[model samples]
Target: MNMDIKEIDGACHCGTVRLRVRLSDGLNSARRCTCSYCRMKGAVAVSADLGGVDVLSGADALAIYQFNTMSAKHYFCSKCGIYTHHKRRSNPNQYGVNAAILAGVSPFDFAAVPVMDGINHPSDHAGGPRVVGTLRFVASPGE
Candidate 1:
């Protein structure tokens, strides 16, 4: 591990599963996806290498979910139902870490996040990459 790489600790909501992620690019790689499933889950993900994450415990408590082309493998805690990470479909060599699960990241920290064009994925479309929009989630009480 290089000096720039920082280790972050995280777990499921119920603390059933624990994780230690080696963030090579810190949190700067965080971005949002607009894929059908991703849009529904609404999580901002950060990039990580295949070897960056270690499931410290409760491996059996993790459940895998895959849909559509099934290239991206989404993992969540079966007990608490918290999405921890996923294997990238665009780049199988890399993994997408749940930015919300990483240490020190707050929901208010992000004012806007770039949404990827997962609807017309590069793998399935000929037009290449696209960004849908900058997503905002902040809201006041009772609208």
Candidate 2:
């Protein structure tokens, strides 16, 4: 996480459900998942700690979907069907927020987003893959 990461506002497609989330790494952890569900409903995710999200309005409009292990809770707007965020199955302590939902963040803001191995999830493995390579970001065409 960056030393100066800040909180930002986000909302569903219909402007019903609003949220204030303190981004963990200021979009540094943005990624795309290739799991069965994500493959169907495409959304880029950025990281936020479990305590970082605050539902500011229209909590009643929020809908949750849980499947498989039921550890990950995916949330969206009941009316708009806009994905908001989800409790990551791999790391229950962290959240994967919809990057496109943030005020100024866009999926295109990332030139290359690492696809996590969710199809073969880490939580299912006895001991996780030991080595993690460095993550390098390339600015989008115009930067």
Kindly report which residue pairs in candidate 1 clash with one another.
none
The best candidate in terms of TM-score: 1
Give per-residue CA lDDT, model 1, range 1-143, as digits (tens): 12244778877788888899987677766678878888888888877889998999999999999999989999999988999999989878778888778667754577777878988887887777678788787878895
Error of 1 at 76 (Å): 0.4
lDDT at 7, model 1: 77
- How many residue pairs of model 2 clash at the backbone? 0
- lDDT agreement with native, every candidate: 0.82, 0.82
Tens-digit per-residue lDDT, 29-114, candidate 2? 77777679986777888889999999999899999999999999999999999999999988788899998888877786666777
Clashes of each: 0, 0
Among all windows of 10 consecutive residues in model 1, the one with the lowest summed lDDT is 1-10
lDDT score for residue 39 of model 2: 69
Q: State in Å the error of residue 119, model 1.
A: 0.6
Please give the RMSD of candidate 1 to the true structure: 3.8
Residue 12 alpha-carbon offset, candidate 2, angstroms:
0.7
Could you tell me the lDDT of residue 90 within candidate 1?
81
